[model samples]
Target chain A: GAGVSQSPSNKVTEKGKDVELRCDPISGHTALYWYRQSLGQGLEFLIYFQGNSAPDKSGLPSDRFSAERTGGSVSTLTIQRTQQEDSAVYLCASSLGQGTKNIQYFGAGTRLSVL
Target chain B: DQQVKQNSPSLSVQEGRISILNCDYTNSMFDYFLWYKKYPAEGPTFLISISSIKDKNEDGRFTVFLNKSAKHLSLHIVPSQPGDSAVYFCAARPASYDKVIFGPGTSLSVIP
Candidate 1:
């Protein structure tokens, strides 16, 4: 695709339910990132993946929030027992690689609402 | 802690005038800064960027100025047009870090 792709542009789920968000980065891009943004708020880093190495999961808010990148092309972010606070837009971005000059391209984002 | 911040939540400017958006960061390790433009119900797109070594960078009608000593940066859009009315976000890439820190964003309104 021309740009990053995210699945299920909007998802509404009940509290305590597990929700999964997916992202398909631009072709051949080596780095992928996940971010979360609340209503009218700044983006919060969620996770990062570089090539085949272990993903940088330090930014995950809690253990319930986990992400896995398969084959370095697509990624899935799963939130177990979603909370009201988890209601936010999940954004996916990708860059060429780890460089200061490399700019990231973003997806339209998936708005997740936990009721 | 909020490393990157845009104090102004919104700004209004007349078309054909200059629109200035400011961003400040507490982390001194940031060496690369970028500005992004976003529209409602859409993704953000890259507008301009500046490195710490360069005090200013210009791309057509857009320019970014960086002040390393003050840990501040600003994006200037000359001859702002109605199409430029959108939320502008400031991002910084810290030294040796792959993730970029993003600001809350400032909504820019260009009126004709």
Candidate 2:
């Protein structure tokens, strides 16, 4: 793909339901990131993956939030027992390198609404 | 506390005029800064970026200015066009950190 791609552009789920969001980064890119954006809020970092190294899950809000990147390519963000506060746009980005200076390409994002 | 901050929520500029958007950060460890522009229903696109070592960087119509002393940075769009209307976001990353912190965006309206 020419750009990062995310699945389920919009998802509506009841509270306590589990939701899984998928992201496919650009080919050959070694770095991937996940972010959450709430209404009228800035993008919040969630997780980061660099090659086959362990992902940096420091930004995960709680135990209910978990993510995994397989083969250093596709990634999945799973939320268990979603809460109303979990409603937000989940964005995925990819970069050719690892670091702050690398330019990240973003996907259109998945808007999750937990009712 | 917000590491990166864009105090102005919105700005309006007449077409052909210069559009200046400002951002400030409190963390001295931030070594890289970038500006992104986003339209409705679209993901943000990279506009310009500057390293802490340099005070300025320019790309065709967009330029980024960094003031390390004040921990401030600004993005300037020369001869702004209507197509430039969108939400602009500023992001910063520390020297060794892989995560980027984004500021609350500023909505820019380039009026024709």
Among these predictions, the greatest TM-score belongs to 1
Candidate 2 residues lying further than 4 Å off, grouped into runs, are: none
lDDT of 1 by residue, B11-109 (tens): 999999999999999998898999989898777888889888899999999999998999999999998999999999999987687778899999999
The residue-level lDDT of candidate 1 at B93 comes to 87
DockQ of candidates 1 onward, in order?
Answer: 0.77, 0.74
| Chain B TM-score against the true chain B, candidate 2 | 0.99
lDDT of 2 by residue, A32-111 (tens): 99999898888888999988888889889999999999888999999999999999999999888664468889999999
CA lDDT for candidate 1: 0.92
Candidate 1 per-residue lDDT, tens place, A59-79, comes to 899999999999889999999
Clashing pairs in 2: none
Task: Note the Cα lDDT for every prediction shown.
Answer: 0.92, 0.92
For model 1 the local lDDT of residue B26 reads 96
